[model samples]
Target: MENNQPIISVDHVSMRFNLSKEKHESLKEYFLALAKGRLQFDEFYALRDVSLKVMPGDFYGLIGLNGSGKSTLLKVISGVYKPSSGTCRVGGTIAPLIELGAGFDMDLTARENIYLNGTVLGFTPKYIDSKFEEIVEFSELRDFLDVPLKNYSSGMVARIAFAIATITKPDILIADEILSVGDFLFQQKCEARMQRLMSGGTTVLLVSHSIEQIERMCNKVAWIEKGRVKMDGPAAEVCAAYKQTTK
Candidate 1:
């Protein structure tokens, strides 16, 4: 049974990072400045007063220009960063494909990385064993399963990561620019897999620069600019407005 409540809630969230102004030629200078308390810095807010609510089973898209906080918001929801203010609440299990090879060991074989990443996502060894073949099949990397991940191309790594993440239905799937990495055919395959997951009641939060992709796959869209949400509404309407701004 699908619940009427929101599965993900982000309320007035803000994230700030401190960046140093001085550039050091060497590590010694960097450490010396740090010890002398002479490291001048500035604060940059990646997200400011951003609030959002995603209903259960909703396919939500976040659209923004580069450096416009789209990925930051996903990171916040994924618990990769502590908000500078406000709160974010999530219901049920989450499978996050925030960055390619984020949870993977580059030195390990593709097959080994799958098991390692599965464990990180809270699956037992036996559960991973059961899904091993399915993941490999979907990844289409059966030939490279025993090869070290560092040897694979970016697209190949993305394939393995996507296959591992979506091996089972999760309550929420957070994707940040994942579709942009793979080839066109593989991208279509991933989209089909996501559609199946949505039908099975998985809520998805997607971040993409491709407005067309967002408009096609998402039911709702949020447009973020300069660390704040400029628009939030139906996918088509919001995407139309965002496109106008870019032109």
Candidate 2:
């Protein structure tokens, strides 16, 4: 990162969900139980008192075991979930590749969905028209443009999603397991694109399981264990420590 000012800041952030203990047969039954004061619940905290900061132009990686709240934390950053307590703040626009096929319409053709998903991501129709070919070129799915997205493989879907998300180079790019869906060669392509963005002063926050990838790409890292930050530092130090514990 080039600047001392944090482009993204998380302060004592905590996300909590109240899961109902009782399962009702129907909507009426659920309402009846609620009316009778018979409802019970348990609190599940996906993130607790977690704090971190990302500087401008940073390639920050988040590493953790599955179900360790890595995705949840990304959701919080993406504004998909509001924290039960604390705050998450970002200084600039965010392009989030937080889920596979998130902004796509499965029944629609890949061509139709480019316009659909593109508008949803805040691009104007004229703007999309101008950049449509570039998006297709990067995805390398020109032949499949007329095909329904439902027929596409996961890796194929990933290609389109990533190409669209990275088209304009927003102030911050947030990714969650995006590289894992693609084949090795495709993964390298994505990394190269990210490096290009980073060199142009874009900030990146990524969540990935590949330790080697994290070590190679990220200058900074945070190790989350059981919904809390277990360690945060330079990638080499954090990844090495995390590897030892897992071993």
Best candidate (score: lDDT)? 2
- Model 1: weakest 10-residue lDDT segment is 16-25
The reply for model 1, stretches above 4 Å from the true place, is 23-40
The sequence of per-residue lDDT tens digits that candidate 1 reaches over residues 72-103 is 89989988898999999998899999989888
Cα-based TM-score, every candidate: 0.93, 0.96
> Residue 156, candidate 1: how far off, in angstroms?
0.8
How much lDDT does candidate 1 score?
A: 0.92
TM-score of 2: 0.96
**RMSD of candidate 1 to the true fold?**
2.2
Residue-level lDDT tens digits of model 2 in 173-241? 999989999998999999999999999989999999999999999999999998999999999999999
